[model samples]
Target chain A: MHKTALFLAAALLACAAHAAAPKPAKPARSAADVLKDSPTSDWRALDPDNTLLMDLAAGQVIIELAPRFAPAHAANIRALAHGGYWDGLAIVRVQDNFVTQWGDPDGDDAAKARPLPAGASPKLPAEFSVPIERIGKSAGFTKLPDVDGWAPRAGFAQGFPVAADPRTGQAWLAHCYGMVGAGRSDAVDSSNGTELYVVIGHAPRGLDLNITVVGRVLKGMELLSALPRGTGAMGFYDKPEQRVGIQHVRLLADVPVAERPALQVLKTDSTTWQQLLDARRFRGGWYVHSPAHVDICSAGVPTRPAP
Target chain B: MHKTALFLAAALLACAAHAAAPKPAKPARSAADVLKDSPTSDWRALDPDNTLLMDLAAGQVIIELAPRFAPAHAANIRALAHGGYWDGLAIVRVQDNFVTQWGDPDGDDAAKARPLPAGASPKLPAEFSVPIERIGKSAGFTKLPDVDGWAPRAGFAQGFPVAADPRTGQAWLAHCYGMVGAGRSDAVDSSNGTELYVVIGHAPRGLDLNITVVGRVLKGMELLSALPRGTGAMGFYDKPEQRVGIQHVRLLADVPVAERPALQVLKTDSTTWQQLLDARRFRGGWYVHSPAHVDICSAGVPTRPAP
Candidate 1:
């Protein structure tokens, strides 16, 4: 809705102002322009320790964790990773326009549940919300210039999309597409960082600050996104054969250094990133008209092979 | 961004006034409360002329057109509907975290392209935006209380989700999940309403006001939403056998009266609708904490058997 207003306002202003002042016209800067002029320092390197590489038959997906936000879940997840908790698990749910969840398929039943590996916490306090102080000053939270109906401030923090409430002094990662969150039952504390789901449809912002978001799928999102929708309740595959098997999930540090994914996420604080946002904000050349506002989720973060 | 500021300001004002007064024993009213108190006169019924009934293997899907927003495309689509253009076409693309598109599988090749049947326009002006005057005063264009990065005023106009600019008096539909749009090539004017796509992922606001959005799938979205993703670029199926055939798409009025779907969408401007919105805006009972703001796309428009 915020983006809708910005888009209309920007377009109207441009059209009206352009007609009123035809000569020596100054063009409005697009999101791309802002990114183009941004300094390289705005970018940050991905911490390999915080990265997880999920290999599938199609390709490998890179996920960077938000340990600063969900430290406990991140730690437990790390333990699960090191212990190969998900090596034999399968993506058991692919609900169209909703999510794709993966974990121990038998976790739902208490009788046949998989045991938590050593180092993994059997239970932990819900890491849904955290103190805003944990968000480092250098996180490059380029706050969206528009107003949001959901949070006091909505923007990128430490390369992860986030929303915060100044009044509550609480901040949390938003449930944008590709964002990975720990799955839970009716109980708020039911999640144990073993069962996880990645948002694969509309940004379920409603889930923001309500669940612990561990990381975001940086690559191979297409592979997971393309999985067949499950037939059971909430998109769970009723039959075990309906699920897609996961080849493996390995931490970059655990693998041979040379075999790790060579990747770099564009620094959110860098000028290049700002320019990228601007470019998308203001469509040029081929675009007959440009939208004035850009939603935090609509903005794309560039990634590439490490230089 | 705009919504965030408004919420903060409101919260601040509420806090300041309550600082001196004893906390009221009653629950705090939410944005939904403001809407629930709206008069009954604000509500309106769906226009049968602008409605379409799409019967799928799973169930029925109802779509309401925004003729004022995209007249040319709507007209072309209506013609196609009458001519049974999509009677045997299939849903050919299901791009993960993106869209579910339906159209002639051979649209790319001119030789295989089906000619616009009698009464259908082979070429029509892109109906991306329309004059604001056409949107009536009784349209209930209550702008969202937030600032959008995309449009001047993002809100509902006559029960249809819309974006507008007061300055230019231009308005168009926003592309949210379940919203349908005409599919086209790189050429801005290529779409003639024969091919259609539905937003099934995060609101692709970038496409807002860029393409012609005809209507939204009112039900059975999961049927199309859950399809397997195509392997080809843009999520096109690599093999011809992969396409899911469309049994037929007929206007509800054209079908036998006894065969019509007995469904009704919650009147967007109704008190019940406002209460639903409030319920979501201030999820209280089970929720540990509620998100201060809710995205328009996430708002529920209830559907059930007509009384």
Candidate 2:
């Protein structure tokens, strides 16, 4: 059977309708096919120590912390999770075409605010971007072919979407869909990892280098993205009941090995990753016009269930 | 009082936490502030004949068709609405990070399919892009300052996101968030505007010239963006019951005058729109490192309820 249009269901059904039509010219391999042909070495399992499991009523959201990019924020998040700081908090905001934020709803009130857990600092140096040297010589940065408006260069840095400045010699995580950040106040050092927001819409590249991006959601983004939009200002829920409760958050390392999610991400440095990018950049299957360019965010890193 | 952190809800509450603190340094105006100061003439009311209201259990989605871009598809959609072709159909697909698609769930089955309503075509010459001359000299094309990798140039044509290639003398509607498109099969001219989908997540620019983008949803995007993801292939619901029922679809012109939504979109050619773009490109409040560029999609055309 002819391959389905990757983006549209109607196209899939329409292709089915032409069952008697002669086979069209052989289509080029798709990104899915490239992944299928990848070697096992091309995929890497999530590091439990740097992984976060956010449990909600709907399902678990797996986040891979990019400590290399924002070590302070990542460490703060670990401390908060270890202390069970976010066990009973709720997702208080779901802004359409923007972000879904979760933290303490009463955090604004001094009298009602929850105290920070042990080892978590209220004020820390903002890790908006790390020095190029910090990532080390073997950071595995796969540069994109196209230019990005937000940064001098954009590509994948160790499996995470990244933007870099050659002149400044600094690199930061790009705010692509599912990329998570530490929410801060007017002061650059105000964030303590208590408040977190994930990019759920278009790549808000403007946010790049302005906030401490600590990680990206690897799985179960649907749980956060599909939540009802909050009705109040900045998409804050009008009532407490409207907030979706976060049952608990745990470092995957803290969870039993058997309970940990079996997730694997394609290595950005692998040949298979390049093949996948090429497949997307060049037209195949149902694609008519070959968009020879692929934005770094659009060429998303592939993740899958472990075999 | 200070402007809240535009992207992070925690920043809003954090500002509240510092109520008694000394006033922070003066911050620059935000996009919201720019819109607040915009002149009444900078806004244009939606043309009733070109506007579509899709009623669902959640709420209504308002789409403004761009007849200047895809005349045939727009006319076919108008006819479909006139005959109530989509009155009882269900939204069959909700692909995370992609689109929310709706049409006849039985469209693929010849025996079960409902015939196209009177005057609606089953095939259409793909209006993927048009000669630049078609838009006329007064088309109000406001080019973006940043270069887009997907096209030679990207900007706002009138109030809609658009991409143009001056070398080819062609321009097309861009695949921005909330932009709606006609779904097609392997054949280039397979779509007839019956199966429509809306971009609900990141801007899938790769789909720009590959599909017929008929219009864009101006309001109530949360209604479509927050729908549950379909479990079946291509984000199609596995079971029919899981699909969200469409109460009805109607042209704003066909509705009673009092029943029509009083909506207005920011004119792209206005000085206020340019100021808004600059405000986003040159960050001030709560920003440490200013990203001096903004993608065309990020520089979204604003819309709001009429005064």
List the DockQ of the predictions in order.
0.32, 0.36
Prediction 1 global C-alpha lDDT: 0.70
Question: Interface-residue RMSD per candidate?
Answer: 6.6, 7.8
lDDT of 1 at A88: 73
All-Cα superposition RMSD per candidate: 6.2, 7.9
The lDDT values for all models are 0.70, 0.81
Q: Write the residue-wise lDDT of candidate 2 on B1-307 in tens digits.
A: 0233332111112112112212224454577777887899999998988999999998999999999999999999999998899999999999999999999999999999978889988888999999977654588887775656677667788788888777778899999998999998888788999999999888888787888999999898999999999988878899999999999999888999999888889999898887776666556666765565667788778898999
Expressed as tens digits, the lDDT of each residue in A87-161 for candidate 1 is 878899888677899998888789988777789998978888778776657565766654444565677876788
Per-residue lDDT of B92 in model 2: 92
Best by lDDT: 2
Give candidate 1's error at residue A58 in angstroms: 5.1
